[model samples]
Target chain A: MSDLSDERIREEAKKALREKGLKCVIGWSAEGTPTFASTEEEIDRLSFNRSCVNNLVPYLTYEIRSQRGKTRDGKDKVVVPVGVVVRGCDSKALLLLLNEKILARNEVFIIGVPCSGVVDPRAGGALFRKCVKCAMRNPVVFDVLASETVQEDEKDYSEVEAIERMSQEERWALWEEILGDCIRCHACKRSCPVCYCDECLLDPTDVAIKPDTTAEEKAHRPLWVERSVNVPENLVYHLARLPHLVGRCVDCGECERVCPRRLPLRLLTTKLEKDVKEIFDYEAAKEEGQKPLIAMSCMEDENGFIM
Target chain B: MSKSILRKDKVAEALSALGKQSVVYAPVKNKRGIVEYRELGKSASAAEIELDGKPDTPPKAIIFPQTEVLLTYRKDKDGKFEVTPARPDEREKVIFGVRPCDAIGIAVMDKVFCGGKFTDPYYKARREKVTIFSIACDGPMDSYCFCPSTGGSPAATEGSDVMMYDVGDSYYVEGVTEKGKKALEALKGQLGKPSPEQEGRKEAIVEKAKSGEGFTRKISAESIAKLDNSFDSKYWDDVARRCLSCGACTYYCPTCHCFDINDEKGGERVRTWDSCQFGIFTMHTSGHNPRAVRAQKLRNRYYHKFKYSKDNIGRYLCVGCGRCIALCPASLDITKAISEVK
Candidate 1:
């Protein structure tokens, strides 16, 4: 994909709506954040820059009911095709979504844009942790190429290796300090692109309870986790989310970016991503019919940690 | 009214002196480099008190914590259930270096938690035990501020015990309440009387602060008048399309006071900060939800800020601190949304 000028990208966004008949185009608004553009006038407000950091792929999920339009018929309701602007990382999220059968590849018209790297607002021009080690700066898949694909250097997993080298006690202490900062605000889970469960397993309502318990007692019962915000419970909540995102997380770093506490969540998720690469010899969102690493694992897996 | 002048060099001394008498919470940098309000004692730095702009986290947590245990329940040997209420910290504390908008945020929260017929005992206990020492903003901290638009000025003194104005080398402080007067007495000899020229300088500073800078966004009374009719408009669907429904905006907001009370392990009851943007915020025990759609949830945020808060409390819920604008991943600027109302 060739790098399209920010103006050219905006122009193409309008074209997608007018010519391609997309119900709406999702891109950066004049406010320098993700916006939905349905008309030419609204598309005129679309602009892109280094500050456009949000992965727009998450909005495609049904958790946000407004994004899914009304069905024409009772059962097989036809959804209007949605046009989305995707950076390098966002393109991969789309790929993973397509592989999971969550989204039909033809349902979305993608405008893939090549990138140098996005600026971290907190660090003021410094690349985000995920972008710093990004192996791909060009979209892996797209319908419309916004930029000519550019070559980029690959990143080594030194950060994950450093954490892997830590003693078990040292690692526990590190996680305790980090997760202690978590307020259980759920910002990280909510901002994730691949966390699309309609009712998350962590929700207390979804937990099974004894049949004899009353409604009030059912609400108060601790199934797997307590409502407390202690370090242990917070760790359970975060660590639980990592497995669900195992082969799906695009490492977009939206979770870390949106965290009010500024918890370095990428540290944990990236380790899982690296493990998937090492153990199963698989990288996420690379091809068309690719399955998740966990979905294709074998019984002869290494037991290095069992000792 | 007791008056005092606090020099820049003496800030540390004054804070340390105040700390000896009562706990003091000032903005200090955490290990992550984010400035948040922390207690002014062992391991905390008094020099890191951010006075130039709003701190990353507001001082509301001092009164209403992010998460608090309301009560601890246990069963006795006789198998009878017993509940013990959790007591709040009764020690007096001072909130130092709070910006005017955040100070107004405390005042707004007071209406919700303290003004109604039934007051939140937890919030009231903490609110009464704390003293607010607000630093009047000389101008908007950044381009996102719109305090004046919401009937609040940069130099507003709605919720402060002591209001301090920066005038050259020192701060011209005036005690606004009896509690402020008592606190000022501790710094009696350390302070000096301001000269007429210094008083004039303070007036000039307040005037400039009151006449806020040119803001990129504006929301007037007229624009919000017809905000109700726009509830069903397609504009909400468009905005909702891009909204990630993350709690960053509401959690970081200074005046958002919504909370959820739940039972933890050992039957301990706790209340934690919850956001309306979450899909399950309005989910009932019966599995019914009034605001099931994301559009309604998004609309409810704006309506609560502009319409519902005003009708119920006679004041807008938002203090225009701009945390929502600055932190939103989708750039869902409330100021832009408000201007587009009607």
Candidate 2:
């Protein structure tokens, strides 16, 4: 690991914040509660902790935009130009936002850091359950580097690799075994960083998943499918949840780690991620300024399937 | 009674004059064959413009950015919440050399933003202020493109404020709306009266766009409507198995506009974009995900595009842009699904 002290990093961050035209600096600070903070000075906050796991890019949506508030004189303050701390993966989100023109490059100052994986609280036991299989420990796009940079071993995809080793029938049976526990609570969706819709189709009142007794009875009753968690409905429920991450999932692994049942959620996502890389030769959040695979097109893209 | 022909060589001068008048965004090449919109400088070359092909990125970035700050709020000294409106950079922009499919995509977004009960004021202001200059595609630039399948011909003039056709050495320009007429008037000195051959060339290109191997994946609008009732159909499982749940289809789609909104505030409210294909999209606070599995999520994506969106908006959410078919990791093409929906 490259030896760079956290103290040195905070000193640099403080210096950047003091620069003229900067409104506020966004970085992770370990106040008794571990979360991202927008602070005016380094001394006012505690130093970074390994548990500062939240992606800071999401905060920019509100920090830089004009919302409700007024100065003491009753005049509105200008939209604050923010300075953000970005890791390699987080920088991709920033690049996407810039490419989308959501956040103007001039509006926010980026401090790119080469990350050496973050600790996930869900993965390495209850304390860090989400940190066990982090692929991007190194920050790809930091203005100032922090932490000792070390080359970690390649991630062990043994869980997904084992699933791949199964025959088609075994795989289907495995999914059926896992999905049989689903209760249709949307906890996974709520915790996802990318699941940002206004109205969800699975809402209780959604016409698509009709609440009418007749529709429900006809749909689940005939197949000997239990309205409760029987084999069929559970399988269907599990199938419904996986596709939502397609190109947008950055392998943050938040969904799997957050699952209360500890259903092998990461297995499903990792399998898809692996397939995407192998089949389409694409990786999610792999490059800065690269458009998400689905948002782009090429004249040479294979279209043998399209009639 | 105005027909103007601009020689291909004078295009830069015309663009420069237009840039002087307003912000002009044109295509420029990056590392790969990637074409992205960059501000047109005086030295910007017309040669960089790909009139026939689709850019690697969509034009939606100019309008509906990925992470727009809708509004910001702060606490006052008295602890009262103060709301401030995001001051948008309001400038007249002219988006030049957009393909027919992308132009239709913008029009589709117009329906979503302007035709809905809640008007997205941010999107509306940018869209209304900007002028679209569409370049007609003379032929299928990629095999995956199925603009004709989605009621869009490559040369269709459905969405452009102004439509341009390249005929040999000259570009035939026509005003599709009053805004286009005003934009054309800004370049009066560079425009020449059109010759009969230019008109003939334009027609020929239009004919070529129409006559190519039109998308063979045909599904009746009536059949798509029946999808809501056909939940037990084996097609869902068959297709879901092949689908890697990568969400390439919806993200690249011109009309697949399902999005999630959430608050990003460390302690306050901030909303950002979300997708439906994710298992988390419908997960409840109580730990119940109504759409918990891949099959249901995949079905929702198809139903949203083919059935639900059509029911709500009177048009299928998919515009046959073919971006999904081209980019899907598993090669699970929606066109094939539509064809197989018996």
Q: Provide backbone clash counts, one per model.
A: 7, 76
Mark the regions of model 2 whose C-alpha exceeds 4 Å error after superposition: A1-307, B42-47, B210-229, B265-271
Off by over 4 Å in 1: A1-20, A44-47, A62-74, A203-223, B214-216
Query: TM-score: which candidate is best?
Result: 1
lDDT of 2 by residue, A1-307 (tens): 1224446556666676677355666665552122233454543463445555545665554456533358899997666576766655566556656645566676777766555555543344243433444556566555666655545446557878988889999998777767664433344454454554433433321222333336444345222122233466456555655566565566656555434345667777777777777757777666656676777657776667685
- How many angstroms is residue A199 displaced in model 2 relative to the true structure, after the best TM-score fit? 22
* Candidate 1 Cα deviation (angstroms), residue A129: 3.8
Model 1 per-residue lDDT tens digits across residues B174-226: 99888988888887656788888879988987878667665555688888887
Q: Which ten residues in a row have the lowest lDDT in candidate 2 chain A?
A: A221-230
Candidate 2 chain B weakest lDDT stretch, 10 residues? B263-272
lDDT by residue for model 1 over A99-144, one digit each (tens)?
9888887678888888777778789779776777677778877887
Candidate 1 docks at the CAPRI level of: acceptable
Shift of residue B304 alpha carbon in model 2, Å: 2.4
